[model samples]
Target chain A: MESRNFKRVYVWELPVRIFHWINALCILVLAITGFIIADPVAILSNAEASESYWFGTVRFIHFATAYVFFFNMLLRIYWAFAGNKYASWKAFLPFSKKRWNNILHVLRIDILLQNEKVHDIRNISVGHNMVASLSYIALFVLALVQVFTGFALYADNSDWFLPDLFAWVVPLLGGDFAVRKVHHIATWFFIFFTIVHVYLVFYHDWLEGRGEVSSMFGGYKFIREDRLKKTPGNTKEKSEQPSESKPEDNPKEDEIIV
Target chain B: MATKTDTRETYYESIIKQGYSRRDFMKFATYIAAYMGVETSMIGQVVKSLETTYRVPVIWEHFQECTCCSESFIRSDHPIVSDIILNKISLDYTLTLMAASGHQAEAAKHETMEKYHGDYILCVEGSVPMANDGYCCIAGRSARELLLESAKGAKAIIAWGSCASNGCVQAAYPNPTEATPIHKIIKDKPIIRVPGCPPIGEVMAGIIVHMITFDRLPELDGLGRPKAFYAKRVHDSCYRRPYYDAGLFAESFDDENAKEGYCLYKVGCRGPMTYNACGTIRWNNGVSFPIQSGHGCIGCSEEDFWDNGPFYERLTSLGGFGIESSADTIGKVAAGVLAGGIAAHAIAANVSKRKELKDRNSRGRDNEKQLDD
Candidate 1:
C-alpha cells in the first residue's frame, strides 16, 4: 500500500452524532413495539389479567420511546439552526442549483451503477452526501407523521393535553381504524429505511475508505489531504464542486488514507 | 274515513288500553332510565312525562334504504315499548306503521306538520339520494324536499340508524345515487345520530325516553351520536377485553381459543374501533349481542364502514389497487422485494470491488517497472 496524506475533517458535530444514534435506537424500539401492537402474538399465560400486563407494558415502552423520538427530533431541528454548517437544516434541503447537481451525480454513480468520471478531490464530501441529506429530510417528514398519528390515537385512551390537541386528527382522517392503519404502514417505511441506511453506510465505508460508519460515533472523518486543500471556505457548498479544482487522471490521486 | 282521535287521551290511557299494567309501565321507565345512562332517580321524571305530556307527535321518513330501522324499533324486547312508542307516540306518520296509505297518509303527515309545527320530532330513517334531482322520492316529492319541509317545523331531529346518520352502504365508494346523510343536507337543525346498522331497540327507546323526560336533545359526541351510547368503544366494555390486554387472540373463528371465548381481534373484530352500547346494553333484551353469540362487532355504527375494508380481515384494503390488497400484504411484499434487491446489489458490489482491486494491482506493478527503467 502506498503512503498517503490525510487530514481529519470535523464533519458531524457532537449534537448531530448524539441525535443519529439515539434516533436509530428509537426507530428500532418503535418499529418492533409498533408491529407487535398491530398484530400481537398470543402470549399464553395462566396468570391473572392485571398480573399479565405484557402487552400493556409493550405499549408503554412504545409510547415512552415515541416521546423520546419526538423530542429528540425537535432538538435536532433546533440544532439545525444553532449547530455547525454540516448539521445545518440548509444541508438537507435541495434548494440551490449546485445541491441539485450533487444529487444527480450521486444518483448516477452510486445508484445507477454508471461509469462516471472519478474526480476524487471534488467528490469527497466532508458531511452527508446529497442523496443522504435529502433522504433525512424525507425521514424527518415521516417522523412528523408518526408523531401526529401516534398521539392522535393515544388521545382516545389518554387525557394528556398534547395528545388531546391532535384528537381531531382521528375524525379528520375518517376514524380511529383508518388512523391506526396509516400508523402501521408508516412503521414499515421506517423499517425499510433502516435496512437500506445501514447497508449503504457500510458500503460507503468500504468504497470510499472514509470511515463513514465510524464518523457518526466520533464526529470526525478521515478525508484526503488533497481534497481538504481543495475545500472552499463556504462550508454549505462542500457538497457541490470546488471552485478551484480541475479534472485530473493521476491514479495516485485515488490513494485514500484514514 | 278518518275520525280524528281526540288529543285528550294521555299516554297512560293508551298503554292501559294496550293491556299494560302499572307495574309493567314503571319497570319500562326504570329500564329506559338505565339504558339512557340517567340516574335511577330520573325514572320518576320519565314516568311523569308519560303520564302528563300529550304524547309528542313524531314524523318518521324513509328514503333510499331497507326499512331495517323501523323493523328494529318495532321488535323492542318488551311488548309495551312497541305499543307505547310505535302505536301510541308515533301518531302523525311512519310509512311502514301507518295504516292510512296514499292521500290519507300524506294528509296525516301534512296535518301533523301543520298542527305540531316547531313542536314535533322529525325522525329520519334513511339516507337522502341527491343524484338526478333527488332520485328517492315518495308521495310525488323528493326526500330532500320532504326533509327540508318537515325539518323546518321540527323541534329536533333524530337520525335513526347508519343510513340516516352516515348514509351507510348507499354512501359507500362510487355511490351512484349520491346518497348523503341527513345532517349533511339539513345542516341548520340540531340532529342526533343513532348510528348503528339498525340501532339497538333499547337504545332507540332510551333516546326517546330521555328526550321526553328532559325536553331537550341528549349530550352528543363529536359525530353527533348520543354520548350515552357512543362515548366508549365496545372494546372498553367487552367481556373478552382482558384477553386482548393479555395478548390472547383467537386466531380463527373455529380455533380452541375462539371456542374458549378469547378476544376476536384476530378474527377481524371491529370492537376496538366501534363505539356503541352493544357491550353494555346487550341486544335482544340483554340476552346476547353479536360478540356473546361468538362473532365480532362489524363496526356498523361508524361512518363509511362499508369502505373501511373487509368484514373478516384486520386493516383496511388500500383503495385504487383493487379491493383485495391489504396494507400488510403490500408492505410485506415491498420489504421482501427490497431485501432481495439489497442482497443482489451487495453481491454485485463485492464482485466489482474484487475486479477493481485486481486492475489496481496490475497498474501498480506497471508503475514499479516504469520507475526501474
Candidate 2:
C-alpha cells in the first residue's frame, strides 16, 4: 500500500490574482475595440449623424480600457517589489543553472512529451514555473508597446495631457502610418499569447494533478510533503549548507519505481 | 561680386512701381497678417517691415525636383503677392524666374552669394542627391557643393516643398540617388520645413511675412515645421469630421456618400494621420482641397509616405510577407491555425488521459490481489 499526502501551500497573493483577472478583462476589451477601430463596421442607421455615434463609442471604449490596462500593469510592477517570493520579480529571471535545468526538464515533459519516466520531483513549483514567469515578463513588455503607440496615435485627437506626452513618439517612429502598423500587429501578439496561455494552464492542471487552475482563483496550491523536504538544486543552497552532506556533488539521481 | 543693387528700393516702392495703389497695398498687408495667423494689431508692423526691409536678397535654388513649388508660389490668389514675392524681392538668382541665362545667370548667383553673405534667405526647392558625388548639378558644380556654399553665407534656409523638406518621391524606397533633404545635410542653420507636395502659396508668403515682421523664425515643431500651420491635423479641423465620428465614410470617390461630403477615410484618405493646414486655410484661395474635390489625400506631406503603402489601401501590408498579405490577414491566419492545433492537442490529450487512467486501474487491481495473497 502507498500513502498519498497533500499539504496546501499559499502561492499567489490577493493582489497578484486581482492583477491577472483585471489584465485579462482589459486585454479582451482592448482586442475587440482595437479591431473595430482599425476596421469599423457599417451600421445602417437612418437617423441624423448626431444620433448614431457607434465608431466614436468604439474608440472611447478602447481608449478607456487602455488607461485601465496601463494602470493595472503599473500596480502589478509595484506588487512585484512588495509581494512574497512566489509573486516577486526575482521569480521571472532564469538566473541559476538549476533553474535552467528545471526549465529544460519542463520543456521535455510538457512540450516534447519525452522522458516521462524521469519526472524529476524538483520540477514541481508551488508558484509560477520559470517558463510562465518569463512569459509574463514578455507580456508586460508587449503591453507597454501598446500603451506607447496607442497614446501617440490618440494624442492629436485627445484633449488630455498624458496622451500629449507620447506625441514625440509619432515622429520618432517615422510618422503616424508606421506607428499605426506596429500598434495593430502587436494587438495580434496579445491574442496569440492569450490562446496559448489558457491552453497551457488547463494542460498543466491536468498533468500535475495539483490545483493549478484553481490556485489562480484561490491562492492555494497542493504541494507534495516529500518533495518539500528535499529542496530543488537551486533552492538547496538557501537551506543550511551542511559540511558533510555533498548533495551538490551528485544531485539526487534516484528515480521512484512506480 | 557686389550684387546689392545700388538702387535701394524697398518692397513698398517696388509694389507701388508695379501699379498697385496704396489702398491695394494696405489690403494686401492686412490679408497677409491674417494668413500669418498674427494679431490684427501686427498689420502695422508687417506694413512697416515691407516699407523698410531691402527685399531680404533671396536666392531660390532648384535641385532634383519638379518646379511645382515655384508654380504654386506664383499662383497665389493675390497677384500683388506673387509679383512682389517673385520679382520685387530682388530674387537675384533663380534659374526659373531670372531672365539672365548661361554665364550671366551664373555670375548673378555668385554675386548674390558674395555680396549678401549672411544676409540672404536661401530658399531650397528640391532634395540633394549625395550618391556619386551628386546627380543634381548647376553650372558645372554639384548641387551638394552649391548648397554648402550658399548655406554657409545664408541667414536661414526655408525648405520649400516635400522634396526639400523630406526626400519626397526621389528618396522613396530603393532610392538609387540617395536623395537627402536639406536639413539632413545642413545641421547648423534653421531649416523651416514647409512640407506639402507643394505647400499652399499663401502659407509660403505667410512664412516670409512672419520672418520679415518678427525678425525671427516662426515657432517650429519637432519636425522643424511651423507650429501654427502644422500643429493641427487636417482631420481635426475637417468639416467631414462629424461624418467620421458618426461612422459614415465614402466607399469610393464616385459614391453617394462622397458626393454628400462624408469622410473619405474608407477610400484611403490620410487625413487622420496627416498634419497640415489644408482643412482650415485650404488651397487655391480657400476654394477647395483634395478632400473637397472628392479625392483622398495621398499623404504627400508625410515622411516616406510613398513607401508606407499603396495610396488606396487603408492598411499598410506587413513587410517580409508576399505583397498582398497585411498584418490583419497574417494574424488571423496564425490565430486560426493555433486554434485548430489547440483543439487537436486537447483531443489527443483526452484520449491519452483516459488510456492512462484505465491502465492505472488495472495495475491497482493487481496490487490489491498481491496484498490479499
Candidate 3:
C-alpha cells in the first residue's frame, strides 16, 4: 500500500459547515437553560421561590433561547432540500437493497458492541449508512416534540400568542405533568448520542488517512489516486491517477492535509 | 293512591292540633331543598311534590341494625324530615317507635302492606343475615324471608344507613351471620342507598326529598349511593386540605400539632379517601361530625367501613400524582446525568484533538524530508 496515493475531492459547501456549528452551539445553550428553568439554583441565599417575579424572568430567558434554537432548526430543515446530494434525507437514509443490509449489519455488530473492524471508514458507506442517520432523525424529532410540549404548558396560563398553535398538545398529553416527564426523559437521549458521535469522528482520522474529521467542517477529502480521479490542485506532480492498463497500481501521497 | 286513611287530613289536623301553622310547612320545604343539595330555585318544586302527592304509606323494616339510623333520622333539624317522615308521611309501622308492639305492631305492618301493596315505599334500616338458613329471625319469620316478602310489591326501596347500604360492623371480615344489604337480597325494585355509620340527618332527608320531588331516585354513583352525598371525596372539600398541601400534619393523637388544627392525616384521619357530606351537611343541626369532634373520620360512609382497618390509624399513605416526589429529587437525577455527559464529552474531545494533532504532525515530518530530496 506504500505506492498508493489518494487524490483529493471537494465534497462539502460553506453554508453546510456554518449551519452545522451554529446549530450545535444553539442546542448546547438550550439544554443548559432548560435545566435551569426546571430547577432554578438559588445562587443567592435570600432569593425568592418560583412564584416570585424573578422566576418569571428565568422562564423568559428559556423561551427566548428556544426561539433562536428553533430558528436555526428551521433553516437546517430548508437546507436539506437545497443542499447537495449527501446532505439530503434521501441520501442519508439507507434505502438501497445492498447498502441497506450493510447498514443493518453495522448497526447490530458495531453500534451494539463498538466493533473495531466495522469502525474502518472503508467499511462505512458513502451515505449515512445507518447509525449516524438514525441519530440525526431521532434528535430532530425529539427537539420538535420538546418545543410542542413546552408551548402547550405555557399556553395553559397565558393568552393566545406564540402558544396558540401548540395549545392542543396539552390535552393530548393529559396534563402539564405528562409533558414535563416526556421532556425530562428526552434530554438524556440527546446527551448519550452526542458523546458517541465525537468519538467516531476522530477515530477515522488516525488509522485510515481519511480526512473524515475535516471533510465535515472543511468540505473536502483525498481519495486513492490509483482508484479515482487525480486532483487538479496536484497537477504539478503527474501519474497520480494510474492507467487502466495497469490493473493493480500504487502511488505515494506527500501530504494528508484536509 | 287513596292513602287508605286520608292521613293527610288527620295529619294536617294533628300538626294544627300540635299548634304548628301552615307557614311552618313552607319553611320546611325551603330547608329540605338546601339539604338535598338541590339548587335554591327548586324549592317550589319540592313543596309541590310533598303537598300534591299522598303521603307514601311506609312500612319500616328492622333487622340486624342498632336502630341508630332511625334515631338520627327522627332528630333531623329540618323539622320536615322528622315531621313529614314520621308523623305526616304515614310511617304506619316501625318496631322501635310504634305505640303498639308484639302482635299489634305486626298487625299494623301487615295492614299497610296489604292496603297499599305495589304503591307504598319500603324503607329498610338494617342488614339481613343470610347464614344457617337465616337464623336471624323476627316473629318466627326469617329476616331474609321477611325482607323479600315486604319488598315484593313496594314502589321503591331505600336502604337507610351503612348497615343496609353496606354490611357495616356486622359484615366485617369472617362475618358469621353473613348480613347483607337490601340490594343483594332483592333484585327487581329500584334501590337507593344512604350509607354512613349513621348517615347525616340531612342526607337522609335530602334523599327522600329528591325521590318525592323527581318521582325517582336521586342520581347515584356506581355504589348505588345518591351522588349528591357521595360524589366528592371528603378530602376534596375538607378544611384541612391546606394543611395537607403545606405538608403540615399531626404526627400523633397527643402531639402538639394536633392542637393547632394541622391535617389529621398522620393521626389516622381517613378524610382523604372517605366520601360523605360530613364537612358540609354535618350531623344534628349542622353541629359537627366525628372529625370535627376531635376524632378522625372512620370512613363510615364508604363500602366495608369496618374492614378498612383500625379507625385510629392513618390511611396506608397518600398515593397520587407526585405529591410526595419532591422537586429536589427530580433535579438531582437530572443534574447527575448532565454532569456525567459533559465530563464524557470533555475527555472524548481531548482524546480526539490529540489524536488528530499527532497524525497531522507525522504526515508533516514525512513531507518535509521528501521536499529536501
Candidate 4:
C-alpha cells in the first residue's frame, strides 16, 4: 500500500451528529410502534380490563415519540440554515450543475459499479455526495408526510390545538382510512431507506478508508491531502498543512470535495 | 286524500290538535333537545321555538333505497316524535306514509314545491342512480329529475341515511347502477348528511327538530355531517374501549373474550375509524348498537364502507394492493426482495473488488520484471 497524506477535516458538527442519531432512533421507535398501533396484537387478558393498559401504553409511546421525532426534524431544519456548509440546506437540494454531475458520477462508480479500476480520489466527496444529500431530502419529505398523517389521525382523539391544525389533512386525503393507509405505506419507505442507508454507510466506510462510519459519530472525516488541495475554495490554504485548516478559521471557504 | 289546506298550523297547535297535552309537547321538546346535544339551559328555547314555529313542509322522496330510513324514522323512541314529524309536519310526499297515490301524491309534492318554495325541506331517503340516464325512477320521472326539481326550491336538504349521504351498499365496488350520493348531484344546496345504514331513529328526528327549533341548519363537520353526532369516532365513546386499551380483544365471535364483552377490534370493529353517535346515542332509543350486540361496527356511517370490508376482517387489508394483500405482506415482500438484491450486490462487489486487487498486484509485478530486465 502506498502512503498518502491525509487531512482530518471536521465535516459533521456536534448538532448534526446529535440530529443524525436522534433521527435514527426516532425512526426506529416510530416504525415499530406505528405498526403495532395499526394492527394491535390480540392479547387475551384474563385479568380485569382496567388492570391492564398495554395497548394504550404502546399508543402513548408512539404519540410521545412522534413529538420527539417532529421536534428533531425541526431542529435539523433549523441547523440546515444555522450550521456549517456540510449541514446546510444547500447541500441537501441538488439544484446546482455540479451537484447533478456529482449525482451521475456517484451512480456510475458506486451504484452501477461500471468502473472497476482503482477508485478515483477526486470522485470521493468530503461531505455528502449528491445522491446521499438528495436521499436525505427525500427522507425529509417523507418525514413531513408521516408527521401530517400521524397528527391528522391523532386529531380525532386529541383536543390539543397543534393536532387540531392537522384536522384538515384527513378530509384532504379523503378520509381516516386513506390517511392510515398512506401513513402505513410510508413506514415501509422508511424501512427500505434504513436498509439501504446502513448498507451504503458501511460499504463506503470499507471502500473509501475515510472513516465514513465514524464521521457520523465523532464529526471528523480523513480526506486525501491532494483532494483537499484540488478543491477550488481551499486554494488560499494550499500552502498550509491541510490538517491544520479549521472550518472556523475560514468559514467562507466551503471546501466541498466532490 | 286530503286537498291542500288553506291554513298552516304551528307545531304546538298541530300537536295539541292531535290530542297531545302541553306537558307531552314540553317532554317531546326536551327529549329532542337532549338528543340533538343541546344544553339543558337551552331546553326552554327549544320548547319556545316548537310552540311558535310553523311545521316546515317536508318533501320525502325515495330513490334507490330499501325504505329502511323511513322504517327507522317512524320508529323514533318518543311516539310523538314520529307522529309530529310524520303526521303533523305535512309530510306532503312520502310514498310509504301518504294515503294519496299516483297523480294525487305527485300533485301534493308539486303544490308544496310551488306554495312553500324556499321554505320547505327536501328529505332524500336514498342515492340517485346516474347510470343509464338515471336508472332509478319514480312516477315516470328519474330520481335525478325529481331530486333536481325538488332541490331547486328547498330551504336545505337532509340526506337521511348512508344511501342518500354516501350511496351505501349500492355504491360499493363496481357500482353497477352508478348510484351517486345526493350531495354530488345537488351541489348548490346545504346538505346535512345523517349517514348510517338507517341512521338512528332519534338522530333522524333530532335533525328535523333541530331545523324546526333553530330555523337553520345545525353546525356541520367538513363532511357535512352534524358535528353534534359525527364529532367523535365510535371507539372514543365505546363501552369496550377499556378492553381495547388493555389489549384485550375478541379473536372470534364465539371466543371467550367475545363472551366476556372484550373489544371487537381484532374481529374487525371499525369503531376507531367510523364517526357517528352509535356508542353514545345507540340505536332503538339508546338500547344498544352493533358493538354492544356482539357484532363489530360495519362503519355504516362512513363513505364507501361496503368497499372497505369483508365485515369480519381487520383493517389490515389495503384496497390499493387488492383485498388479499395487507400492508405487512407488501412490506415483507419488498423488504425480502431488497435483502436478496442487496446480498447479491454485496457478493458481486466483493468478487469484483478481489479481481481488481489481483489485476493491480499482477500488473505491479509485471512492471518490476520489466525494470529488472
Q: Output the better candidate (1/4) by lDDT.
A: 4
Best by lDDT: 4
How good is the docking of model 4, by CAPRI class? Answer: acceptable
lDDT of 4 by residue, A1-258 (tens): 344566677789899999999999999998998878777877666699999999999999999999999999899999999987888887777776666778899888778766636666666777899899888988999999999999999987788899888899877875677788788889999999999999889878866667999999988888767655455656453322342234443344554535
Q: Is the docking of candidate 2 incorrect, acceptable, medium or high quality?
A: acceptable
Mark the 10 consecutive residues where model 3 chain B has the least summed lDDT. B314-323
Alpha-carbon runs more than 4 Å astray in model 2: A1-3, A229-258, B1-7, B344-373
Q: Can you write out model 2's per-residue Cα lDDT over B16-86, one digit (the tens) per residue?
A: 99999999999999998898888899899999988877677889999989999999999987888798898
Query: Can you rank all candidates by DockQ, best first?
Result: 2, 4, 1, 3
How many residue pairs clash in each candidate at the backbone level? 0, 0, 9, 0
lDDT by residue for model 1 over A94-132, one digit each (tens)? 775666777887777677655445545565556777898
Residue A76's lDDT within candidate 2 is: 91
Ranking by lDDT: 4, 2, 1, 3
TM, chain A, every candidate: 0.86, 0.86, 0.74, 0.88
Instruction: Tell the DockQ for candidate 2.
Output: 0.44
lDDT of 3 by residue, B70-173 (tens): 99988988665687678766788888887888898888888888888888889998998888645577888888888888898799999989899888888876
The order of the candidates by TM-score, greatest first, is 4, 2, 1, 3
User: TM-scores of all models?
Assistant: 0.85, 0.90, 0.53, 0.92
Report model 3's TM-score to 2 decimal places.
Answer: 0.53
lDDT of 1 at A203: 79
Greater DockQ among 2 and 4 belongs to 2
| Local distance difference test, candidate 1 | 0.80
